[model samples]
Target: MFIESAGNSLRTIPGSFAVQPTSLQALFSKLPAESLSAGQTLILEGDVATSVFHVVTGSLRIFRILGDGRRVITGFLHAGDILGMSFKSHYIYTAEAITPVTIRRLSRKSFENEIAVSPDLGPAVFHQMSDEMAAAQDQMVLLSTKNAEERLCSFLLKELQRTLNAGALQTAVQLPMTRLDIADYLGLTIETVSRTLTKLSSKGVIETAGRHSVKILKRGKLAQMAGDGDEYEDDWRPATPQPERIRH
Candidate 1:
């Protein structure tokens, strides 16, 4: 069954697994559950890919350091997301918890053994991999072609969809990641992200519920800015009167 939390909806672990719950549970019953505090490193770059994680709660940030020691955030893994799938022996990027997290760890050998018995598992894994790849490609386009405003808009729209899925079209979405995390992911400076969000707020495209929550007031306009077209116009409604604008 699905439940809403932190402004996003998520399924139970079994449902989220995208496989027969009984089969998945029986296949990895020996694996233990692990917990990490916020900001704790779950997996480091270049570490052996011994196990894959299934997120039961919270989120993780995947990032890498450049030659100059600058951090580049690749993406975030939310509740129900999987991590540590690698073709190589080692992981390419580090993964850390953005919030207190709970995960189920399945060793690679065990995972492979299960797949050997259930050939259908291979296709499910492939589908998950393909979804992640498509998201990566979309990020590439956002970074290469979009301006700061467009990038932020695209990020907000995409995040809403990822977290809320069907409810994303019209809802107040909570951003689990910080502004700095978003700046890193979008390849923009913190100041630029703040500015873009301020501009959006001033224009009544969005309203700030708090530091981390945003009510998308003009989904149609925001969608258009994000290059998603105006098909969302029918769902658009006048925004609530915003508070006095404050310069960041």
Candidate 2:
């Protein structure tokens, strides 16, 4: 009886505990918690948009399926990032919890009602969306870069800084996304990404334990290794050849 009680008390991911926006807090004061397990398909591309989710805990991996049915991981969304952004069209990509997740469910009707009432929310959401777009442009540069090491380094720096800005501590940056997801997102093969990570670890720039655990030890050296260590504008550009356009 005691053990079951303790187990039941475990915190569930995606619960109402994650909702933090001042306006959302007022709306879902009575909202209940729910769970989304890792590797479970939460949504599919083209699924009709009905409800949106507010991640209460855990991480979500966003991926899109190619025509050949291969899943390409676009990015990983951590706690508090909005999942559904499009209303005119359905979800552009599918999202799955990479870890156990909990979320507060918001119906379109409820969200619209709130927006209608609160003029502040619309601008806030738009600002968030614009920020996401700028991040995407950064990724484009990473993707097009020819140097594998440069690309890997850029990815690490960006990933770490992003999480730190989102409430994670600097010394210890948790990689909620899998290495394979990182490789795929950066356009590197799994083996290459693994090798690069091992190299960086051995060189004392980072300390990696297993796949998802990463501790950054030397920030300056890593930025240098990626050619971005120098403050000069020339060093920021990738040293490798440009990627060729793949005709779809």
Candidate 3:
């Protein structure tokens, strides 16, 4: 399932996951659950991919460090997303909890065994991987073609759409990640993000409720600025409410 917003089809939202097969959910429920505080490291880049995690709650930042020690955020994961599904021996990026998080850890060996025997599990994993690739393609376009304001508009609209999926009120979009996190994820500087948002607010396109929330005064205007066309003009809601998709 996917959430369509402003012409972008997002397979999952921040607080919800794609529909898990009943068997899979049961399997996850039987696994051990672990909790981590905010800023805790869940997996490090280059570490052996020994476990796959099912996020039960909270948000995580997926990123990699450059040779010069710069951090590039690949994406953000929320509840219902899975982590450490690498085919390679090591994880490609580091995952850390940006908020307090709970996860169910499944050994890679067990995961592979289940996929081999469970008819539904393999297809679900494949679908998730495909959805991830599509999101990555969207991010590539945003970075290569969009200006700072356009990028911010797209990000904000996407956030609103994600919140809508979790059945939250459409009045305010929640942003759990900080500006620095947004900057890294969007490939812009923190100053640029702040400036662009301020610019939008001046135009009455959106209003910042606080550090962590935004209210859309003009959804169509914001969507237009995002270059997503008039798809958002009709209804502010998705045709079918879908669980959240992964950002990285």
Candidate 4:
């Protein structure tokens, strides 16, 4: 179900935890939406963790800058993804927009208040955090054991799955981040990332749709190369089976 507020909309994906519309409305009504241009920094490392952000549209890159000035990308956040759930007072990574984006900002205090008052919101947050933790563990496996080809294949399949789950019908998966960002996230060099993508396109496993998109052509083969028996299996499932009610 979808909820619309101030010309921006939010929807919960099927097969995932559902937060009641009333809870979401109460939470979001206290927050304001902001628009950001590509390359804009939303939050910086060492900054106070005062608020959390919900991606209403576009994508964000979460990364940490090392002392030597190397940027290590931790993950990518797409539409419906939430960030700033750190238990520490300061953020460890910086969040930057990869494309023109719209985001709703909920202060830490407001979020805690909502969770305390709304029973559904607390469990929904917990489920989302658990899902993120599982994803991080999978990424660790990819970085530690998977080869370059396998890593690229895994990344593509996961992105395709995420796009599909977001209700996108097209085969093209939007890649708003730069090659450097992807390289950092996958623990590969930029050259390796470019070469692997080129190889995949040539092999007909995928096709390049301009600079910022890819279309998967041979999903089964790609999944095999990633060492997964089938297409990317998601661990994210709804905490409850109840139908989501949209609040107008």
Candidate number with greatest TM-score: 3
Instruction: Give the higher-lDDT candidate: 2 or 3.
Output: 3
Residues 149-181, candidate 2: write the lDDT tens digits.
Answer: 988887777666655556554456678777788
lDDT of 2: 0.63
Please give, for residues 1-248, the per-residue lDDT of candidate 3 as tens digits.
Answer: 11111122212212222444444445466665666778777766666666666778998888889999999987888777777565777667877789987777666677667767677877767776788898889999999999888888999877787777777756588788999999999999999999998989999998998898888889898989998888587356643566434322
Instruction: In model 3, state the lDDT of residue 20.
Output: 41
* Tens-digit lDDT string for candidate 1 (29-74): 4445566778777766766666655676887787889999888998
Q: Which candidate order results from sorting by TM-score in descending order?
A: 3, 4, 1, 2
lDDT, residue 223, model 1: 90
lDDT by residue (143-224, candidate 4, tens digit) is 9999998998899887877776666666788888888888999989999999999999989988998878998887788888
Give Cα distance to truth, residue 242, candidate 3, Å: 2.5
Error of 1 at 152 (Å): 0.3
Q: Order the candidates by lDDT, highest first.
A: 3, 4, 1, 2
Global fold similarity of model 2 (TM-score): 0.78
**Candidate 2 vs candidate 4, TM-score winner:** 4
Provide the global lDDT of candidate 3 against the true structure.
0.73
Question: Each candidate's lDDT (Cα)?
Answer: 0.67, 0.63, 0.73, 0.69
